[model samples]
Target: MMKIRKLLDIRERSIRYGSVFRVLGKWPYEPLVDFLLVYSPGCDRKSNLVVSTGHKAGLIMERLPLESSLEHGANGISTKWAISNWDEWIYPDCPIEDVFVID
Candidate 1:
């Protein structure tokens, strides 16, 4: 349990620093973390969901794992990775906009 918490803490810190976060999707630039998928706030017509890749968003998703796919479908967005419990997760560093853009 502590390990998970520790990992979460580290992840949160990374997010706070604008480190690369992962989600399912393709981006034009090279994300800080290449192992996982990168996501931005947006809706998918076919999926009908709103997905995000910001640190805070990922944290929230991590808390609730069961609702992952459902959330993706309902929210019309994809995640870089599958978390344990996305429903109970929270990311404090999420950008104001749903989407994360790199200029």
Candidate 2:
């Protein structure tokens, strides 16, 4: 409980794709902490039919653990990695023209 909460508090958060989200950091990077596959994907890894949130994304990780992490980086997780993994899950990739709103 506290261990999880503590990670949330101290780490600059982003979406994850499984308990073992290769990508880490904030909008950029996060270091590995635990050895268990109990984490979820970041909320950003969604198009629809999903509750977009950091926790929900991470929670799903426990249900679907990936075999490996994303490509390692010091400047944060790669957007390419995020999108490719997301596409694997979403299938029939949904394309957008332009951003209507920025987060």
Candidate 3:
């Protein structure tokens, strides 16, 4: 969760569905943590679903439902799909992945 708070210090407003970010540099405790921080600024300005790192990944915080889905695969395999297809979503060297929105 702190990783995301750090990212929020560099808050990205333009984000999209299925976007991927290649973590750059050496974040503190990056090797110790097994989760990636996924951020979505939302397309309509209101998020329909919030995505965590991946199945059994990311610091879910106090959110039990979100954590359960990732840990238990209760999200109808979407979590598994994300894990299995993680590499496919990667865009070389991109830190924040998404389409820029002009408001």
Number of the predicted model whose lDDT against the real structure is largest: 3
- Residue-level lDDT of model 3, residues 3-83, one tens digit each, is 232222333333333332324323332322223223223332211222233342443322112221233322221333333
Candidate lDDT (C-alpha), each: 0.28, 0.28, 0.28
Name the lDDT value of residue 7 in candidate 1.
24
lDDT of 1 at 14: 21
The 10 consecutive residues of candidate 3 with the worst lDDT sum are 60-69
Cα error, residue 89 of model 3, in Å, equals: 22
In candidate 1 the C-alpha lDDT for residue 94 amounts to: 32
Q: Write the per-residue lDDT of candidate 1 for residues 12-87, one digit (tens) a residue.
A: 2122212233323334222321122223334332221223433433332222223333342343222332223222
* Residue 46 lDDT in candidate 2: 24
Candidate numbers sorted by TM-score from highest down: 2, 1, 3
Regions more than 4 Å wrong, model 1: 1-64, 71-90, 96-98, 101-103
lDDT of 2 at 80: 41
Residue pairs in collision within model 3: 35-58
